[model samples]
Target: MSDLNKLGLAEARDALRAGDVTSVELTESCLKAIDEADALNAFVHKTPEIALERAKAADDRIKGGDAPSMCGLPIGVKDLFCTKGVPSQAASKILEGFKPEYESTVSQQLVDAGAVMLGKLNMDEFAMGSSNETSAYGNAVSPWRRGNDDAQLTPGGSSGGSASAVSADLCLAATGTDTGGSIRQPAAFVGITGIKPTYGRCSRWGIVAFASSLDQAGPMTKNVRDAAIMLETMCGHDPKDSTSAELAVPNFEAMLTGDIRGKKIGIPKEYRMDGMPSEIEKLWADGAAMLKDAGAEMVDISLPHTKYALPAYYVIAPAEASSNLARYDGVRYGRRAQLAQGDGITEMYEKTRAEGFGHEVQRRVMIGTYVLSAGFYDAYYNRARKVRNLIKKDFEDVFAKGIDAILTPATPSASFGLGEMTEADPVQMYLNDVFTVTVNLAGLPGISVPAGLDSQGLPLGLQLIGRPWDEGDLLNTAYALENAAGFVAKPGKWW
Candidate 1:
């Protein structure tokens, strides 16, 4: 029990039930790890008191033989999810002091399942950046680094905090919300397992909205089994969120037979972009080979609209974000800008926003507003919507051809140093989501599994996009690929 913080969710659950470890011991171990790893800035708000309280309750339930799969387990909650009385800022200054009066459906579900909350993990402001650099609380540094390099790297954002914490063993698992590549990319960078379930699989109620249609909450864990276990408790139908699917939640962990025999896995030909790094290409090829070796048939597939996905996603996501964020005027909760004498309401609105939002958030809001403007709505927003449907149709066509899952590299490259791309054109930063935006556009379940390391010794992951509502089959295939890859290398502790 010395390294109890290192235990995955499954391992911790088993240990708690076997009486080899108490929930208090496990929670305290994680708390100690969090205290020591403050340099990572993974958890912006540490709730050791609440965690201990929950741990004591979980221990009693386990002693009475009433433990659920996640009972007595300690995990991190993303700042995006509103835990009652806990600071849920979404890493934006606008909502700096705002605390939700109620818990998010997803986080509440985890609590109901007996999971202890360690704290709110850091993330990009309003969950809007590819790297965690946009966070008002400051960047969540990745624990991984190049050989002997001291330059801090990003734990890909906006779920970077969740990724960094889980990767560094600060927590067994953490919740992450993926708008484009937020969850998967960071999970890849940190060498953890993350899945963005098919849109509507998890409720969005009480979570800060970025792009209403694209945002989906998921789990980032140490391994596939831990992800599977955490995902089971995180997803379910909720009346509070009209977008939440009415389908029954399945026991995803129980479906990890890992027998993907005869499963047709597709390799999209269009993912091979120009100037693609040799390592990423080789990693994709290696992932396909692993799937093939797992008794699955591999076929070359065409997502002809793949190239258009990135552009369409940018247009559509920002447009929705503009609409969703319109409610944050000075009249509502959160910070209000100090006004000069005789300042009118309009000035208050403008000043409050100007002072509240960060650079990236302002840029996205402007872009979104422009796209939805009367003169350009049809040209940009409407066109993007049409293109989005076409992209979704592309996936449908591939899945219709008997493709059980589509395999590709999770990220274009490994984790880059902080401020590396941000100072350049923002498009360079946006390009990080090139390999991930399609899954959100199609509303499909996609997972990133740590497949291998780049030449710099940083983790790289392979993505598997599954048919909608078939996360069980998807997890099984990821399980198979994970087994084949055998990627067990962890970051050498420097923080």
Candidate 2:
């Protein structure tokens, strides 16, 4: 029998069906791992009692021969989701003691599929930073290291905690919401597999809004198979979210045949930056070669608007965030801070918001407010929207010309030291999303497959971008690549 903690969701399900391992025992092992990984600050709040009860019920379900796809599998959820009765903070003081009466559609779907909720994982306050250091709780350290390296390295943000927890065996899989490279970047940093589905495939009904238009929830897991299982469970149509498309979701688990023959793959020419490490470049070349070997055609393509994506995304995301966060101004929900004796409502609103939001959160709020302000609205916000449309058009143009999907490096570089990027200007940090955010802007689907290791031994990820509302194609292509790469996750002893 394999160690309970080492098994992914599918394997865990198999064991439960065979009566080899009970759900309670699996939940206990995950709880133990969570306790051990606590020093890494991978979680904001852990629901041990709820998890145990759920696991026991799962055991009963399996015993009675009534189990859904993910029955008995424990999953760590990022704090951005609204979990009923659980503190669903976006990892900030502003949302302190705020518990929603309703569950996020994504989290509810997971629960309905019988996945035990292990806890709420940590993240950047309102999903704002590249490094996990921006998290209000603390930083999530990468589970992997270079040889015997002892320095604490960042598990990428803002989905950093979910990535770390999955890689460290805290849960079988985890849920992550990507606004700008959140899911894919952290998976690369922590040596795990994560996929960002087509924007509208998964409902965003109860997800705490950062940039509502760009946010797409997806899965982080040990490998492609678990990712497939999670994607299948998380995707579907719900009238609750108007943005959700009305289409039939393919059987993602059944579609992972690893047969990608005669498919045309486009390699964007603009992604080859000057400072790109030799290892990453080789990985890119190797990925193209592997696709060719798999009987796929690799074509050189160009996205002219690539260079402008980062700036446009920064402007647009903050503009939307400024509008969405307005609801949290000491009135409807969240905590209210103390004001001066003479202060009534106005000062209380200002003071509460000031004390609640972290530095990065406050910074984004200010930027958003400025961009959405009356005088600058057209020049900044509207211009960014136009640029975003152009970027989306670039993808549409390639897809129209018979491209099955496009490829790029998930991040320009591998994981860095905890505080390395925080000291630099915010623009430098925003540049990390240059490759991944374009897909979000275009409402396309993308997946990050483990390609290779960098000079520092941290994982390098290869991304595949699919057409809008085509998550199935993205999953199929990623499944083929995962098979070709034969990437296996090996957690470090320190984990």
Which candidate wins on lDDT? 1
CA error at residue 314 for candidate 2, angstroms: 0.6
> Model 2 segments beyond 4 Å from truth?
none
Candidate 1: tens digits of C-alpha lDDT, residues 1-495: 599999999989998999999999999999999999989999999999999999999999999999999999999999999999999888988897988899999999999999999999999999999889999899999999898999999999999999999999999999999999899999999999999999999999999999999999999999999989999999999999999999998999999998999999999999999999999999999999988898999999999999999899989999999899888887879989999999999999999899989999999999999999999999999999999999999999888889999999999999999988855599999999999999999999999999999888999999999999999999999999999999999999998
Among all windows of 10 consecutive residues in model 1, the one with the lowest summed lDDT is 418-427
Clashing pairs for predicted structure model 2, backbone only: none
State the TM-score for model 2: 0.98
- Which digits, one per residue and each the tens of the lDDT, describe model 2 over residues 185-257? 8888777888888888999999999999999999999888889889988999999999898989777888887
Q: Give candidate 1 misplaced runs (Cα > 4 Å).
A: none
What would you estimate as the lDDT of candidate 2? Answer: 0.87
lDDT agreement with native, every candidate: 0.94, 0.87
Clashing pairs in 1: none
